[model samples]
Target: MLSVNNIAKKLNLKVAAGNKGLEKQIKNIDISRPALEIAGYFSHYSSDRVQILGMTEISFFERMLVDEEREDRSKRLCRKETPCIIVTRDLHAPLELIEACNQNNIPLLLTETNTTNFFSQLSSYLEKELAPETNLHGVLVDVYGIGVMITGESGVGKSETALELVKNGHRLVADDNVEIKEVSNNVLMGSAPELIRNLLEIRGLGIINVMTLFGAGCILEEKRVMLNVNLELWDANKTYDRIGLEHKMVKILNSEVEQRTIPIRPGRSLAGIIEVAAMNYRLQHMGYDAALEFNGRLNNQIQKNGGLNNDF
Candidate 1:
């Protein structure tokens, strides 16, 4: 559960009342506009969410003719489960609401951000912070602006290829272990653990800090993994996709990424192959497929010749 105090620190919110309740746990990502609750309706109130008292809600409360009714409604909105109350536009908190929040130990925060923008920002932060996450043993790098996750069995040279890519001006996101979070539907974000950030472990090379060796420009804090390249020792009996017509996908945390299995062999440039894969992925997105073009040309030539020749 994310705490109200953490949210305040992250968003730079100011405390107006109920400082004691800063430790309240925020379970819901949605924010609530307490317009109806302020008008004395609490039947369908979502007390689990953080409350937002914008200009409209504050103005409506001030227009209430009876003080006792206003106080009663304010008290009802400060239920125990309610995460906190945030007043946007730097509006003044009503005395009744402030007193009720203090009595109920519900925090009341204030922010100068517009209500709609703040709602969007807070919802996005909550979604990412509370998203489902998992860790994988791999190396993540940004090749030609595409996030590629290099995965394979132990001692398959994932780090060596990533280091080569880094030397060729690509950015390194993570090495050895990557933490992936499903922030939204079909979007998986990958990052390195805090302890291993910017640190890569290569066999017989010890641990090297990529940022220190290559500067900060070649390091990314996190990236959306767009491709997965799995490496393995070349097997003579295995059939590989030489035509690039097969579509492969790898699933991670409810999301799937374009996957490619590259067979490792001596004298082959893995870095160059992966770079071309990234460029090809961008081309495919832009409605151009080299494999499709080649197949179309082959068909055109065959059709012009009126069929295949038979040998006696």
Candidate 2:
């Protein structure tokens, strides 16, 4: 949730009038132009949004013949649910409109930015501030220019794998707890909380600061999560994907990220496997699939030989 004063200060808008209602809450991310509302049509006026009055809207109101009509329109736009009123291009608000805003106790803000540019700016700011967020238990690391999240049961060596990756020149985004926000459709941005930022925990070894142990280059403030790696204990009865053709996914927030489950066992390097997975994911995105290429080669050789040979 954002208040009218919060956005005004963020966008550096000037307070033209209605200073008492700066604390009004802005619930909707969408802004309204109020062009039709200015033309005496309030059938579908979005009162919950921040009303923007550009040159066109101001001109329409000024062109009205009767003063009562203008006052009525201004009064209707400043309903109880309205968050605030903003004038673009530093345009002047009508006298009746200013009086209406003061009467309704709605904030009146002004900006020198043009209509189109201000719309883009305000929309971008609101989208980020009001985006949906969730907390996740995992370690997010940047490997091979990809955001790889390691998740599994406690003590499954997630932190250990992340430490190894950091030693290999990778960047650590978050440790143990990752706060993810859905900035856009199907895009998740993960970052560590303030208290645990740049800190890693290893069982029996206690907690250590990653930035202090390694250089600042090994720490990332935030990263866009692209893949999820789940580490599980090795179970002989369970079957895992041997070939790379099988695709798995996990949902985090509103995005579905590619998932890979690696079985943990002695003498097996988890960090190396995760590095290869990140690299392979990048390759697949670049239109190169190793599994498909190998399958195609095997099929061609079998057809050329005309039959299977078991003379070994």
Candidate 3:
């Protein structure tokens, strides 16, 4: 839960203050409002917040708030509390105006790309992963202290597996959409999606409440993501990992996460496999590679057999 006002400070946006009376609420308020407010960079408390403008839009926005008759420099001076100003194309915003914004500490980001892509990405980041998360749905279970995310399309036994993991004494972090981010090079964290907070969907059962069913142990606010397991329909034809030799990665932002794809089929236990995978991944992270160990033993055997038996 991030307050929108706090976000404004983080983005370093300037608010034009058409009325100027609203400035006090903007300054003193300390509550998270993840929705979008004005356009520019996302200010703290606004939901889906990001500002976008064309030259014409800028002109109108500027003129709308200022007393302009001479030349309408209002366009250049309009934005008051935009977190950042992003200019597209080979454009100039006049020297004096640029200097004024710089003096006020507004970050003016320039990109060669259009406004569409910029807004798209910025919004996506703020919406999905950047915003603060509250864990109410699902559970954050620890498999030997490694955070494991168990999610599948619809049902496919996600929550049911989580129940087993918790019964096995693993802690639950979150269910449904796990908001993950690489905060640091060595760390990736997971939490719940805001809208569907603390809710898990079970096919043929509609939405069954996780927190209500399992109590406090069934809910987790957040956890560092050591690994991700995406459960998909089991494919008999596809070659599954029998040796854990190949490494898997899922890219989130600039960070690369170790990921495993587990096939789901009848008779195979999903939770058990995910638990094992999480343990194995943690071991690998700790420098214990099973494949490497196997290879070493194989090499030793070959050396003892006089180096590969050239004739055979």
Model 3: how far is 36 from its true place, Å? 34
Better candidate by TM-score, 2 or 3: 2
Per-residue CA lDDT of candidate 2, range 266-306, in tens? 99999999999999999999999999998787778778888
Worst 10 residues of 3 by lDDT: 29-38
lDDT pick, better of 1 and 3: 1
TM-score of each: 0.95, 0.90, 0.54
Segments of candidate 2 deviating more than 4 angstroms: 63-66, 307-312
Task: Kindly list the per-residue Cα lDDT of model 3 for residues 177-269, writing each as its tens digit.
Answer: 666665456566777666755566655667756667767765677777767677789888899887777788866655666778788878888
- Candidate 1 lDDT over 1-312, as tens digits, reads 789999999999999899999998887877789788888778999999989888899999988637988889888999999989999998999999999999999999999999989988898999988888999999999999999999999999999999999999999999989999999998999999999999889999889999999999999999999999999999999999998888899999899999999999999999999999999999998999999998787778778787654520
The residue ranges of model 1 lying beyond 4 angstroms of the native Cα positions read 306-312
Query: Which model scores highest in TM-score?
Result: 1
* Candidate 1 local lDDT, residue 81: 95
